[model samples]
Target: MTLYLHLGAHKTATTLLQNVLKHNEAALEERGLARIKIQPRHLFWHLYRDGDRDAFKKRRRTLARKLQQYYKSWPNAVLSSETMFGTSDLHRVNCLYPRADTALRVLAQLTSGMNRKVIFYVRRQDNFIESSFINRLQTLATSLHLDHAQLLSDTTWCSFEHYLSSFTPSQLSWLHLIKRMEAHFGAENLIIRPFESIHRGNAAYAESFLAPMCATHDLELAPQVYENRSFSAKALEEFIRLAPKQGFANLRSLRLHLQDKYPNTSYPRPMLLSPEQRQEILQTLATENSILFEQYFSDVDRTDISYQPVGS
Candidate 1:
């Protein structure tokens, strides 16, 4: 038995991956893999309920029962949730997965006695940060009660630099994540995939990536459906400009408000940058993420993906 955990660091085609897994659950099972749907609400309920001592004891018992059921239900499982990567508190993480070295380790323990593999997909920081800003706003609106415009202006609201600070330059960088995982779990146990290759509407990309991990199962390729929901650079800038004027106290409030008012907002679309802006962003990214552009991604293939605006 083997358990594969896909921890998304946000905006890395997580929804697409989850959708595909859900659609192919039956087929996956034939190959000895099960898709474990750990409801987000359940995870949150456990987290919050455990925060209170009395509630913690009760929930712990309940959670143990749930875990037993889950273990019995699936030998080889695929569990995914992006929130697993959001927190910076190691203690909180430890409380969730006590014996693991890192969050990845905790995942490994969940599937102990079973072969385990971790898969994480990351985008270029320059591109990721820009999308992250809007994502923060969306999160704020959905989770908190703050004004989006106000939150944008609040220095405390959302800052790309501050968010990125959670992980080391290497940890946040895809190349670094790949190298680190390779070192920790051996290349065979870790898989590093580029978001672009998958986005190219190529089924071969999916096959090539999943083949080794799932050789036991005869899987079928499904048509790829690109959501194409990210916001363009201009729209992102417009939102940024609108954010400060609205006066949000924090990111949570902004997201809550947005969710209340416009529940259908999607992730920002990838922005297309002008040549000058592209050059500027590339130069800035070079300062910390030089290796991402120079080594992780080949220059010949760089033109295929969207670019971020400079100085925004």
Candidate 2:
């Protein structure tokens, strides 16, 4: 059996894609694909964070055997997780995917001696950082309450301005991340796409992601399912203003309350970056993006890789 893993870069409609894939599980099964919905936290999370080589090796072998069983039953076994490359917290180190190499190496070891492929979608740097920062705040608010001191000291509570300034343009390069993935998985085994391809329309975006599952040209998929909608700009503004004053549960409730009151259909997404900032980011990454196109996505539209604003 061939293993298909979706290694998310985050803020790239990963949830939506997962939902769509799940919705069409029966169809995929008929087409020789099975969605393997294992909780990554139990396997990949421990492997990525733990330094004990003996324990890591033990878990890797256990997981590999589990995969082997799935392969015996199905021709295609699939796993999808956004955290496979590490969390947005890695940005605290002032780099996009600082631990990605280590994560990829772990993955390479796990799927060793098997036919494995990885799907990764990458957004433009400025949009990715801004959306990732907002998503990180939402994620953290649901987990732990921060006192005034923790709020001040915690990287998660920092303003978008500080977060954006934390990394140099080179540090956020998708090219650098892709090279690491290619090093581990081989360029031929990776399926890479621009996150902005959703701009072609949702149906097109769904098709691009589902392409790897196609055993033939006529594989059918469910209509696109939208998931994990972003909080409105007003909702996020209120969240940041009141998060420290509230408990974690209260913060989550307040966020949901605010989201209901000021949905994205009425309010815009958080436009933290100005037009100038966006252009600067696009210009800075132009060379690397060009090389990315030439090397991996020569058939994709160059215009699709251009700067698309966060909520646009």
Candidate 3:
């Protein structure tokens, strides 16, 4: 049985993909694809359960026995979990400090002796960094009653370039990431593609994700409306400016009020990379991006990679 693993790099619409898979489980099964709903937390629990070594040992054996049985019966199974990529966004930023070899190695070990393929969707660096920050700010502000002003004040919370500085060299770019992943899972078995560029001719993004093992391409069983939408610049900025004063009750009430308040209002701020920022980021990653286009995606269309620089 082929094991298809969708190891997500977060903020790349992973939730939408997982939801589509869950909603269309029977359809996928009919097409000879089974979604493996094993909780990744179980693997993580055993990996880090240090307090009781004896207990951990017993738990590991039991889990392994169960997985072996599951693996036997499983047919073209697919597992999707963004956490498997080792991305962490504590306060709306990827403060993901991964011990590169260790984390991915654990994943490699779990799928050993099986025919496994990994599907990873990558985003433009600047766009990813900006979207990550915005998503983090919104999530933390609503859930933790965090003050935007204070959160911004923390020197650690800076631009995406600054964010990259904190990451290990291997975690800095998708090129490096793909390199590590290829090392662990072999280059031929890894399917790396631009998250933005791979939707050609597909009715929905989820269909593209399931393309590797699909016997049939009927996606009529799934919903195409993207539920988790991005906050417009105006809405995102206003939410940050106002989050400072909100208590638990106010946070929820104020957010609802804002939604009602600006039903059709245009944003005061731009949510994505400014043209200048995008140009600079491209320049910064030019070499790596070229390598990415050349290596893994050589046979595919290069339209997205051909984005024009700032001044024509």
Best by lDDT: 2
| Alpha-carbon lDDT, every model | 0.52, 0.73, 0.63
Using TM-score as the measure, name the better of candidate 1 and candidate 3: 3
A best-first ranking of the candidates according to their TM-score comes to: 2, 3, 1
107: Cα error in model 2, Å: 1.2
Q: After superposition, how far is residue 49 of candidate 1 from its true place, in Å?
A: 11
Give Cα distance to truth, residue 133, candidate 2, Å: 1.2
Where in model 3 is the C-alpha error above 4 Å? 40-67, 88-100, 141-171, 198-204, 221-225, 248-269, 303-312
lDDT (10s digit) by residue, model 2, range 170-250: 567788888888899899998888888887776677777877676534544335355455678888888777777776557
All candidates' TM-scores?
0.61, 0.87, 0.76
lDDT for 67 in candidate 3 is 47
Residues 77-135 of candidate 3: C-alpha lDDT, one tens digit per residue: 88788765433342333323244456567667777898889888777776676766655
Q: Pick the candidate with the highest TM-score.
A: 2
Report the alpha-carbon TM-score of model 2 versus the true structure: 0.87
For model 2, the stretches where C-alpha displacement exceeds 4 angstroms are 47-58, 142-149, 152-158, 215-225, 307-312
